[model samples]
Target chain A: MPGFFKNKVFWSGVMALVATLILINMTSSERENITLLERILRDTYAPLQSRVTEMRDYLSGPRSIFIQKQELSERIAELEEEIARLNLSNQILRENEEEIKRLRSIINFRDNNLDKYELLAARVIARSPNNWFQSIIIDKGSIDGIEKNMPVITSKGLVGRVGSISQHTAQVNLITDREIAVGATLQRSRETSGVVEGMVEGNLLKMINIPYYASVKPNDIVITSGLSEVFPKGIDIGVIYQVTEEPNGLLLSATVVPTVNFSKLEEVMVITDFWPVSEETEAELPALAEE
Target chain B: MCYLIHFLLPFLAVFLQSTVFGFYSIKGTLPDLVLVFVICFSIVNGAGKGTVYGFLCGMLEDLYLGRFIGINAIAKALTGYITGRLQKGFFRENIIVGATAVALGTLLNAAVLLVLSRIAFPSFHIDEQFVQGVLYQFAYNIILAAPLYGWYYRSSRIGLLKLPGEK
Candidate 1:
């Protein structure tokens, strides 16, 4: 054996191999607990990363920003005029809503309960440097009352939930990440339900374990099934692209194309407060409270 | 000051990699500036220092991710070691050599990640998209290798990157 093979460098390599193997064994993608070291590092570096992003945006172009500001002012005026037109239309809609409320009272009908959510707007500050993990870092964090498992959404549809959080920033695993799954249902055929899983690609989602005989097909809209503790019921998930029978013929699966263009995600709304009431909870409610 | 610049280089590279390079991503895969640096440093240095530095950089990446600890660390360190060992057969300062090393390093990095994940977690499955993403990253890393390797090669020539002392 060569003398170099017995040197300190070789011993270091061997030690590293052993330590890394042990570390990999302890690694978990669904880890709920964050250690003190990881927390401090993420918190300390996240701010610098956020500032670098702002600097990049600032240095993009001063002239372009001025032009954009002028255009935005003109657009704001246009929007104000449109808002007045909408206010007239909204007044008529308010009368219709009041009529509906009265009719519902007469019929003892339950209101569609989705707007109970309070949304907090957050900016996309950074994204995962590696492609193996599909996560985005938002500027808002626990300081903004964002917590783990909080559902994140855009105006178009569901994005993902907060996975981990620091003081000033939070990491959201996108719905297309491998480790995330949402309770999904078919909007057209309420009976057709499945779990929407994140796929390797950012655009594609896999709706798994659909009943073999369900009437789901391409163009069918998929929504949240309200079956999970995290995601609210009736939030749009995606449109089914291709439905196919599973290899075993026991269950079917479909490819759902999400409405949210995740790559282009700039601003998102994190649902801060939502207490979903299930049918079980509804039945347990007292009549006096309803009155 | 020089040592501080060298120390903070990985952090800055990673931040810019996630933010600035994110805009230019091709199908969710971007050029990994940290990996490129690892390869360059390994090519200039030897397998021993390359391996240690790769491990540290990978740890930094994992900490930034705040999820898994060793996935990137193991993969990147292995890539650095392999690239460093292979550099013995090449003209280390040549851009082509550097770019070729990057191409191999990127592929090796992806393979190690895939194999490690597959072994550690049964839920993880490799699919067609994984292959496609790796290819896209391979292209991006090669594109980045030229300028990065040139800088490292020149820096080593000027003694900013102190070579490993003889055994």
Candidate 2:
């Protein structure tokens, strides 16, 4: 028995068994907390990581090329002149017409519906190194009312949700992050609730668990479901890129091309005031007395 | 003291790689200086220290990138351990050998990530572009390994810690 125990292979096998048990126990115990911990870690390290990346960029030298070609400069000047001329004409036309009324209506709609959101403008400071994945760092942070879980967007469409916030910087986990899952709906029919998950291959998102009977079609716009209370309702997420029925005939999935080109993100808007519903409102309402 | 340096240096490398050197792409591929640094540290040090450093570096990376929390930790730990074991059989002071090891290590690291990604996400297809990205990164990393090794070697020397066997 002593000689058998003394064999190195026996000890090695024992160690392997212990390790497997430990791993299985850990995985089972921490299954629920893993996502939350991942989020916290992302938030905490994002700023420092961003700062280090900025320093590295500084070390690597300037990124842009200064094209000093005379022809290019002349073409730029001509375009600027044309743009100025168009701006003048447009301004005169706008002044002569009821442009203010149109703007007022739009503002009124936003005020009535999106009153809770206080929008702050920011610039993109950095981007994820991998092209297949999409994420960005913005110059705004907690100091500017930016916070984790805030929704980030551009005029084009939804960009991502804020993952981390430091005093003066925030990290946005773009819609393309594999771990990101957002509740979204089809804008056209508005009949389905689907989970949007990032595809691992490319900068694309896939909506899962759409009811097979829903009237979704190609080119249907997808918007935030507002079920999670993070992103408000009606924020455009993307246009449906493809749709396929599941083999089971119960569920459908679709690929969506995000509206914001994450690679070229320059200016973004961080929503500061997505007012959450009070707990009282969420409480199951007492059954109304029969009318 | 050495453990702290090991932890901090990899963190610093990851930080720089993500923020600053991240944008410096040549033909759409950037050098993974952090991975190279970790591999070098593992080889110069030993398996135990290498595993610790690798895990910490991976944790820091996971924190910043917002990916699966333990994936990097596990990958890096394995990488460091393997590299350290390799170091045991060979001399650690050869720059060319270090560069080749780094190049191979980077390739393996990227491959591990690809396989893990596939396992974690079976719905998506891992394509040629992904493989090309890994190869391009491997080339870029090898190009920069010599300088990175030189820098770390010089710093350790200046600090009066000889190369692993210099004493």
TM-score of 1: 0.85
In candidate 2 chain B, where is summed lDDT lowest over 10 consecutive residues?
B158-167
* Model 2: residue B24 alpha-carbon error in angstroms: 3.7
What RMSD value applies to candidate 2? Answer: 7.2
**Fraction of native Cα contacts kept in each candidate?**
0.58, 0.23
Q: Best by lDDT, which number?
A: 1
Residues A113-223 of candidate 1 have per-residue lDDT tens digits of 456578899988888888877889898987889888899999899999998888888899999988888888999989976899988755689999898989898999999
Q: List the residue pairs that clash in candidate 1.
A: none
Q: Chain B in candidate 2 has what TM-score?
A: 0.85
Q: What tens-digit string does per-residue lDDT give for candidate 2 at A1-291?
A: 589788886686467435533443344221322345544544555667556545655655654345557868898999999999989998897685556557645544222244346889987766664443457778787777777788888888788888756566677888877667888999888889998877653556889899989888889999988776677777888889899998998999998988776555667998887775444544422221111
TM-score of each: 0.85, 0.66
Candidate 2's TM-score reads 0.66
lDDT of each structure?
0.83, 0.68
Q: Model 1: DockQ against the native?
A: 0.62
